[model samples]
Target: MAEDGRERLGIVAGGGGLPMIVANAAIEKGMEPVFARFSDGMTNDSIIGRSRAFAWGRTGDAIEWLKAEGVQKLVFCGTISSRPDFRSILPSFKTLKRLPRALRIVKGGDDRLLRNLSRYLESEGFDLLPVQAVAPELLAPEGVLTARTPTAEESAALDLAHRAATALGVLDAGQAVIASNERIIAMEGIEGTRAMMRRVAEYRAARKIGRGERLALVKAVKPGQDRRFDLPSIGVQTIDEAEAAGITAIGVSAGESLILGFDDVIDRANTAGLAVCGLGGEQGTAR
Candidate 1:
């Protein structure tokens, strides 16, 4: 229990470093942190040492555990790689009874599932907090994040791709769009940004050896999205993927996209001669 009379903060960690970051942030803020994490997805098991943690299969059980620990507020973090196989989600009878409504609300996307999950947790007496509220520093800063500036041709491509990505986002499609030489290479679907980047790389690699012209990757939040869940995120891994794929520039919404491992990502981008920029209010090219 916290001195402020608030119950301990409970975290549902899915995968990657994001969950660990959230847990650490909560502790720094003087809140007791408890985590319910998926077994094979979390990046570091050490996170369990920092807070109370349990595996995914026992989520319903974990909720009870949090209540026992006096946790009243909950935050969910990390990516649960979308799966077609539904067998993995062994919902308890409590959750199972609401499966139909959950399915109706989710409609097969990360954002929808999280929204439904948040609603369910709130109904169970746990107040769900926005993941960003834990660590607002993870949000990307405005302006360029690389040493190299975009070329005039690259700028044109970026503008086109940004608009396309923003439009797709509005439609509840994925957040990333890859474009090169004025042609759209790929639009992110359920496969995610990394998968989309790999596909673009494969296509580009098949065409030529070293043309030097690189694809532009743009990611942004949907026009009217709830900020709590499914906020756009990029990290060191994202930069590595773009650099490996010979992408010249990456654009992300300034306040909307969370830049995990910010310093390392910038260092990698600079070393690779990749231009990383945060889009401000107006959608325009950043060099």
Candidate 2:
């Protein structure tokens, strides 16, 4: 807590706009935001003043810095594009004791890895908060968001994509899938959503299909996923990628996925004539 009685929030930032978005929201809510920036992660420059940089393997250093900053609540946002190189680990005495467990966590599948990592962090005496807990405005709302509601065929495709995405998530595999012409063409893997979309684009192009063909991109939270972190997210860039990949519609689990720049995402999808909707309980309202 600060002298003003506001909690100091620690953001473990990686690549993308999300860390900055969370920081801005924390500030608005009267929290002091401190950053633990990964050296290889693409942290935005705007928050540099309050950030301390640490390498992926320097767990001890990062935690020590956050503690020194008086942060008790930590939230993780953005993407860690690749796994850390265990060979490069530089452990201090404090973390060295837990090094073996950390290695095993890294060896597990994505969901199991995150669940264990959350426990590991909690063991370090800090409370973990999910992104939506700090910034509920970022959560995607239910119902169609764009001017173009999905066609009946496109809606059916969206349902197929969602089912495919859930299957991928159940395996701790990935969160997004592209279904085209009633068939699953791609399921995100370690390559991620952007790469998967690019692959879809290339596949379509190879078959001599032009832009704006029929397809849907759907993302969902893994069944029994730890909601404390790593919720699947989409943004304006998602719309751009979908358009590029010839996807005509996009669906995400309502209140279960983040839609960064929500209005902009809707506007972009509308302008592109793509259908965007959230699939789940009809309880959320558009922000």
Candidate 3:
């Protein structure tokens, strides 16, 4: 707690355990976390126990709630589905007027929207903190995660996929992309990574025979992305889905992407004989 009353931390939570993780981390740091959640696209009630939780509709209402709670700092975390249908935002009059302009500026993707939102919040006197500022351990470490390193061909495929995915991210498109044999099999769009991978697997199955070999999945962050929200994240479930989809290698940004389950995810990748690498720069050599 700081001199300004109780030091309150604001969390704009979406779906998944990431929000809970952020709340717990804040608690450990001795700051009170106040969660502002959306009714349709947020975590379960269990998160309430970890922090001061409130349900809000419009973005204006959310900001008001945070201001009312005396939150001086803000953190945005978790999986907010990229698809428009998954979001049930009820912007207030002020937010509604600014919404279109912000959407047009950022193209309405997770990273862009959140960055603009952070700027808006800052203009209103709230300081938005980096998501990693509270959960540093979530950042993916540089190295080969699995026991087996990527083969030469798989490494090449990963390199290509990484560049493509990063470019897509810059366009506010998506975070993950699937590539094999120097061809883009699938690019993540409004649907999440798992859905894209599942679609790619279905397509491969339809092709039959020689086409079913292991594919490379690359997840990267946009070069200038704001780290407060929609940072690329993977976990044990991500590894399980990759293995089930017959993915051979998973490449993520060395320091930018987050690995939620960290050890468990790496263990599963190693057990499944899959290659996981945190890649950086133009060079794609396995770490």
Candidate 4:
């Protein structure tokens, strides 16, 4: 992505361990990592040393700062709770210059807006790197990841959940769902996956749906999902939430989702007696 030596990569941080993981990987490979934290997204206390926090609405400010810092490439990572509060960001001169396009972007869906941002940054001479390039180790692999495999019934439930998640993803609705006996019980909304799982737990208790292999949670990449931001991710917390939700199995599209602390996620799933499988492969490649 570099045309010269000015190739320091910036991690456009949101919230989560992802930015840290990517930052470490970039550092290990001897790439300079500038953390450009988003105010609307999650940030860890550990970020103070290397990060410059910015607002999501201050796109121009972020870009101008990156350019000044000699960052020629950027990998957008982590999550924002939702859209930025546009009313709060005082537009920089640069942002005002692109106000029309920026306004259009703010009016679009999240994926569309992110893709537009990537294009806008690239058009401004900065390279946009996919998360995979920075942290291939986090990519989910094909087949079962945990020791436990899906029971026959759960496998069927998995397929159902997968299809449901796919349809939801196509609409850019959300990434995950909790399904039981072929019925969709919960979908990740603005509340997110963990909260959705907790809601499922409440439902099971109220509906008298006893814990067993009767439920499965599935995560799928959106059709033509933008790789720059909001990639589906699972972790030890995911396992814990699933267990709490009476979910006995989990499925994610292979290569499309990330397993943070990959080993720990699998180990936790195994310990919880939950099946975690990465599904989908096309032409012998993880997809």
Pick the TM-score winner: 2
Pairs that collide in candidate 1 are: none
Clash total of candidate 1: 0
In model 3, state the lDDT of residue 187: 93
* Per-candidate local distance difference test: 0.75, 0.83, 0.76, 0.79
List pairs with backbone clashes in candidate 2.
none
Candidate 4: minimum summed lDDT over ten consecutive residues — where?
A: 278-287
- Write the residue-wise lDDT of candidate 4 on 1-287 in tens digits: 23444347888887778888888888777777888987654776566434687776677888888888888888988777767666777777777788888878766666777878877888889888888898888888888777777777788888878878878878878888777655777787677887888888888888757555399888878887886677899888888988888888888889878999988888888889989888883322111
Give candidate 4 misplaced runs (Cα > 4 Å): 1-7, 208-213, 281-287
Name the TM-score of candidate 2: 0.93
TM-score ranking from best to worst?
A: 2, 4, 1, 3
Candidate 3 accuracy as lDDT:
0.76
How does each model score on TM-score?
Answer: 0.87, 0.93, 0.86, 0.91
N/CA/C clash count, model 2: 0
Q: Per-residue alpha-carbon lDDT of model 1 for 116-209, expressed as tens digits?
A: 6677778889887787788988887888877877777777778778888888977878888988756787898888888888887787779742
Residue 145 miss distance in model 4 (angstroms): 1.3
Please write out the lDDT profile of model 2 over residues 92-205, one tens digit for every residue: 676686678778777777788888888888999989999999999999888888898888778877887888888887888888888864678889889989999999889998
For model 2, the stretches where C-alpha displacement exceeds 4 angstroms are 3-5, 90-94, 208-213, 281-287
